[model samples]
Target: MKLRIAILGTRGIPNHYGGFEHISEYVSTGLVRRGHEVSVYNSHNHPYKDDNWNGVSIIHCYDPEYFLGPAGQFVYDLNCIRDARKRNFDVIIVMGYTSSSVWGSMYPKNSAIITNMDGLEWKRSKYSKPVQNFLKYAERLAVKYSQYYVSDSMVIKQYLARKYAVNSRYIPYGADTITPAEREQITPHEARKEDYFLLMARMEPENNIETILEGYNQSNSEKPFQVLGSTDNRFGKYIAHKFKNDSRIEFKGSIYDTAKVRALQNNSYLYFHGHSVGGTNPSLLEAMASEALIAAHNNPFNQAVLSKDAYYFSSPAEVKELVETVQRRDTEKLMVSNNVQKIKNLFSWESVVDGYEQYAMECYLDFNNGKIIS
Candidate 1:
């Protein structure tokens, strides 16, 4: 059934940010293609100032977060919710609840609420004890208010089930395998092809950026290691200071250009994924889709997705050992091939979109029948 859907959270479409924005772009457009009316909320300062994106309508709401700092996020969410309440939407999907859950009651009662419970945010090392406690409280409120929940990983689904005694639907993020033509568009390598390893993630503590850099430093490998993403934050500055003397480590600040990023991933001798807190990471999936030999952090979330196809590391020592041991580029050729096939069959955009569409339909039916799925 074609239902009126409104997607809240994230800084809006064309995905200049993280996973939620990425999913919002794909799912909103996909729903529109399926004949459903979809409206995505965009922050006033978003780069894409258009009234519409693809077939989805964009509602620009005032976001004071730029001037307000951390507290500004709550104001932005409140503004979005206030605007959303004015319009009647059949289903409202909120991506993350670090700020939005506080305004849960402001959502329209006529609509069904579905919250995508992202990885345990309270567990991140970046937040202080007080902020972590607030995050935990926010998570509880998000679960209590929403009619249904969506988990991006099986691990998160299980957490919701055990902690809140609520069943959540598991729906992972999607990725596309890079085409040879796309590689050609990015052009010949500025960095030597397959000579350097790659690590692309936000320079956050929970992302294990420092650990990865330390591990790379400990290893005697002569290959250059390219570190992508911004290094201007407090922790980033610390990492930069600590690894400043290591000439092998090259910090290439956030590469948002899709073609260039894909080329880096596709040609890297090895791709390092050190994210410890999140569910199925978009970067890891993107690296796999690029057929890059991966070495991810050892965790249930990463393990569930990569299984036995990817090498896993925990400490700086382990990462160092891995770097020293896995010398050849094509050593994990079989695993890389397996990862490529996994993306086509399981993590494709079509499958991910279908999963969301099916869940939305089910929630809509339940809401219409005066039944709450939660």
Candidate 2:
């Protein structure tokens, strides 16, 4: 329909690094291909300005300290809303509800604003009291101000329904397409390191990383476990050193390269996801896409994703038991292969972008109908 759209929190898209980035890239590019005029508001640190990345316009905003992390998100996103105010976009999609969504919420009924609420920041135990309180307030503001909210997991939607009384539709993170030949060559069965277990995640306390290490250390199995992700934090490094004597565990540090991470995923004997917070994590989705025999923390969000296909653990004993049980289950491998096909078919880039594309069309029509966009 040649609709004009602008995206905030533009660090995502162009497949930069994280899950949201991959999603943004897919959806934004899909819109561009669908004949919509799209522009992503990016930071100055990004290498390009006003360039066509996958048919989408790239608008670079010059925010000096925006890259500093959580706090700076508000500053840059405020700039996005300010600049977008002068444009003719029919819809403005923002991410990280507290970051760009909050910026759009502050604006009047100028644009149809849709916010993607990826995680529950209020549940994290690491933030200070003041910050946590501020996050809770921001969550309210985001819901109150935006026209609609998109949640990636059912758990998150339920949390919002209970906590903020908002309804969030479940649109999970999409999975990449791995060709049969590629999958065959990359399988753990082909690799000599196939016997090793795998854990991939960003280093954080609430992720229950400490317990995962302790469980691995207690394991009587001779097979080594591969740990991927940065452990720059004091506690993360301390845990690493404590388990240093156990040659069964090896920390590979932060792997920014998706291809390398995928290879590891495709090569692992099994996958371990210990995230205790957030909903519909990208790393977990990617792990499933790689067809890893899985053992995840027993949480509603993880359960929703696995859907009775993978193993779940609540404690160290449970994790060890599930891992061993998965070792003997040939039927579980068949289910993973089947689920891999399902994930590819249902969560592909085409399907995901089509969903977002429909949402944009609806928002555009609502704006044209003189509806009050929150």
Candidate 3:
């Protein structure tokens, strides 16, 4: 069926921000290619001002998050939800429920609301107790209001089924298989192939940036540790201040250039993934696709994705050990090759979009046939 769909809950496309924006960019464009009419909600201030991108309709809604901070997200989400009501879309796929679920009652009743339950937001140390409680409530509201749910991790899917008695479709995020870039591509960053450690993530408490940096600082390894992502936030500033004296640690800031980021990942000695929250993180998939040897945080989500294909760490000690002792063993080389194959066989963007398209169709049919009653 050529369905009309609307994607909500992201900063906007071109993916200047985080995971959901990346998913919105790929999934909206991909669905459009499959003959579905797709619209993505974008913040009015988003860099892309065009009303259309890659055949996908763009809906720019006012976003005051810049001045309002976190509270602004609630307002932005309200605008998206209110706008979606008038569009009469067949499917309205909400990327995450953190800020939007509170207004769940406003979601168009005629449309099938399929929400992607993001990682455990309430568990993040960044939020206070009250905010965490609010997030938990918001989670429940999302479950109560949506006709269907999508979990990007199998672990999250199981959690939803066990907690809410709801079966959510497990659809992992995707990454393109990166071709190896020239070694000199990283020269401008003063990084040499297989000579520097790399990590790319937002400077959030849950991402364990401190733990990773502490471990790297503890190690005697002379290789520079390149930390990507913006450091303008409070946590970012604290991290910078705390580790300023470490000569081997370099805060590279956010690099949006895909080629440069992929080049760094493709040539790094080891890639550190410290995201303790979220399911099937895009950065992890990208690192795998880039053929980087992975050392991911020890958690059910990361374990489910990497299995025995990558080293796992939970503490500064573990990270320090990995950084100091890891070598380019034949076994590690095989692990890198396996990660690439996983990306190709399982986590490619084409496969992820296919899953979304199929699941959306199923949800739409079920809703129309009364198989799903919201």
Whole-model Cα lDDT per candidate? Answer: 0.90, 0.75, 0.92
Ranking by TM-score: 1, 3, 2
* Candidate topping lDDT: 3
Per residue, candidate 3 scores C-alpha lDDT tens digits across 1-374 of: 99999999998887788889999899999999999999999999899999999998999999999999989999999999999888889999999999999999999999999999999888988889998999999999999999899999999999998999998998999998886453345675465778999999989988989999999999999999999999999999999999999999999999988877888988899999999887888889999998899999999999999999999899999999999999998999999999999999999999999999999999999989998533
Cα lDDT for residue 373, candidate 2: 34
Question: Candidate 2 residues 120-180, lDDT tens each?
Answer: 8878877879878888877777887787778888888888789887766567778885545
In terms of lDDT, model 3 sits at 0.92
Candidate 2 C-alpha error for residue 19, in Å: 2.4
- Quote each prediction's TM-score: 0.96, 0.91, 0.95
Clashing pairs for model 1 are none
Better of 1 and 2 by lDDT: 1
Q: What stretches of model 3 exceed 4 Å from their correct place?
A: 180-184, 188-191
Error of 2 at 344 (Å): 2.3
In model 3, the Cα lDDT at residue 63 comes to 97
| Model 1 residue 19 CA deviation in Å | 1.3
The TM-score that candidate 1 achieves is: 0.96
The predicted structure with the larger TM-score, 2 or 3, is 3
